[model samples]
Target: MKTFLLFCWLPLTAQAACPTLLNQQLPGLMGGTVDLCQYADRPVLVVNTASHCGYTPQFTKLEALYKRYRDRGFVIVGVPSNDFHQELERNSDIGKFCLANYGVSFPMATKAHVVGPDAIPLYRQLITVSGDAPRWNFHKYLIAPGGTTVTSYGTRTEPDDPKLIGQIEDYLNGMPAPAPSVPPPAPPRLKAISGS
Candidate 1:
């Protein structure tokens, strides 16, 4: 009985190391699944994206941002969403467009809803804790290491915005704000294109 109990407890203890919010495996944009726990203890930026939205071009800046900081325990996970009616119809196309147009080499998840009751579990937790749903494509959420803190950025926020970079640096340097639950005010956003 002691041996059986010890074996059962071992897996539970290992699972406790990763936060529940990041314990999921999102389907990869290219293929297979992206085990979110692989990024545990690292600063992760999650973005809701679209292939045809005005903010689509932000992919360029996002890619550059990822390349600049990825070596220092930073990662960006692009999530193609159609909630705003702008994403391509298929995952393969999304993979190709991002690579061919923006040269995106960062991690990208397969298409997933980012708003409302049907949102993926990660987005659901993000919205619940951050109190801000994505208003349009390219909505960003910065998850601090250990997943204890999350900062929500609206569509207007640029990928290379200084404040966002500062926050990322804070996470990388292990110096997050005293209270970062609420993000700073967002800049004016462009009107979203409907039925694009």
Candidate 2:
């Protein structure tokens, strides 16, 4: 029992060693701390969201994509922002609104600035490497598995757009397909020499 418990707890502890790009924590909209490291080695779609933006409706498709691919190691992270003055005033309000309006079940961060020098550290790093930043709410950054590749998308690209979906499919399919399960060689057939 103790060994089983230890094995179960190992992954949680291992999250502490995630790569730099994902080695941080943020307040989750669901009233908990979301350790970004836990998502390392998984493809993640990070979006800067706002409650009152014209593109707000994208949440539905975003949630849909999340539901469709999450079981396959895909994640969607929503970062509520007021940089464009479209976000709600409080995290609770933003969380409630998203749930009520779009049925969003993915993780979301507390409201923060996602543009300019005041942007969060992660966003700054994203901008530094991607050479593009959120020009408007709902702008997305798709981080490929292993947290190495990042692709930027403008707000005009809806979550369900074929182009975006294709990239996601490509990345996911690119992962070395799981090795087929091979049964252990049938325990060498028991041979009873039986002192013959």
Highest TM-score model number: 1
List the candidate 1 regions with Cα displacement exceeding 4 Å. 1-11, 175-196
On residues 1-196, what C-alpha lDDT tens digit does candidate 1 reach at each position?
9999999998788688989878888999999888888888888999999999988999999999999988787999999999989989999999999999999998999999999888999999989989999999999999989988899999899989999999999888884333335777999999988995
lDDT of 2 by residue, 109-140 (tens): 89988998899988997888789999999999
lDDT, model 2, position 181: 70
Native-vs-model 2 lDDT?
0.88
Superposed on all Cα atoms, the candidates' RMSDs to the truth, in angstroms, are 17.1, 7.9
Residue 174 shift from truth in candidate 1, angstroms: 1.6
Per-prediction TM-score? 0.83, 0.82
